[model samples]
Target: MDKAIIDFFQNFTTSNHFILNNIFIFFTKIGNLGMIWILISLLFLIFKSTRKIGIVSLLSLFFSFIISNLFLKHLIARPRPFTTYDLKILIPLPKDFSFPSGHASASFASAFGIFLSSNKKSLKWVVITLASLIAFSRIYLSVHYFIDVISGVGIGIFCGYLSIKIYEKIMKNK
Candidate 1:
């Protein structure tokens, strides 16, 4: 079942080359670029109430990525999909571990953080869709295995939820 899903996305990587290429480039760059996330954090900081939430979310995502990619990756040292398979890699080969995608983690961490902070149900759905799309894009680009993406989503969601709960507790205490 998992192989089928990975194979399906691998096929899309070739069939939807144009779209996947653009998406892969976007995600690859944005996921690694700290400047973009810093800028986003700054934007959120402009609004007093959102500032703290933004900081917490950003910190949570950073910590999650560090633990997953830096510590855990080195410890587990799982190989990337392209390394183990015959599929054509749409993006440049990632030098780091591939068990849990950092892109999916950061994307979902931000999306879910925003969803938790906002009162609008519609916006939550929109953010959820974006998170899902980012996760799908990772698989479609052949950069991440099915398990990697799923684990990333789980980790991201947990970090996002934990950050929100911590923020709420801190705010209430103050």
Candidate 2:
């Protein structure tokens, strides 16, 4: 099923160079090192009302990064689909193990953190949409397996939930 989905999307890698180059690739680039999400979290931190959520996002993002890149990726060490298949990679080939995409992890972690801490429906939806796009771009660009991104999303959400629980506990103690 994963291979089938990748094969199906791989078709677009040839047919939609313009969209791939201009849009998906742009998302993929922004996901590099999870830079854009970090910037968004920082922006949220600037406002007093949003500061707690912003800090939650940063904490969750750090946990996601460490778990995805440090532990899970090393433990699984799944090679990218492009590693063995002849696929047109829109972005530069990534060197890390590919079981859990760090981009997906960080993106969803920040999104989930915002969701947990903020009451604004619009902000939550916007963050979710951006995170989904970042995760999709990984598979769209041949950098991750669909399963990788899926696992990343799950792991990231779990980390976010954990962070929020910890924060609540800390507040209660204070």
Q: Model 1, residue 72: displacement in angstroms?
A: 2.2
Give the alpha carbon lDDT tens digit for every residue of 74-123 in model 2.
99889999987889887788998998989899999989998998999999
After TM-score superposition, what is the CA distance of residue 48 in candidate 2 from its true location, in Å? 1.6
- CA lDDT scores, all candidates in order: 0.73, 0.89
RMSD of each: 2.3, 1.1
How well does candidate 2 score on lDDT at residue 154?
Answer: 96
Measured by TM-score, the strongest candidate is 2
Give candidate 1's whole-model lDDT: 0.73
TM for every model, in the order presented, reads 0.84, 0.96
Candidate 2 residue spans exceeding 4 A from truth: none
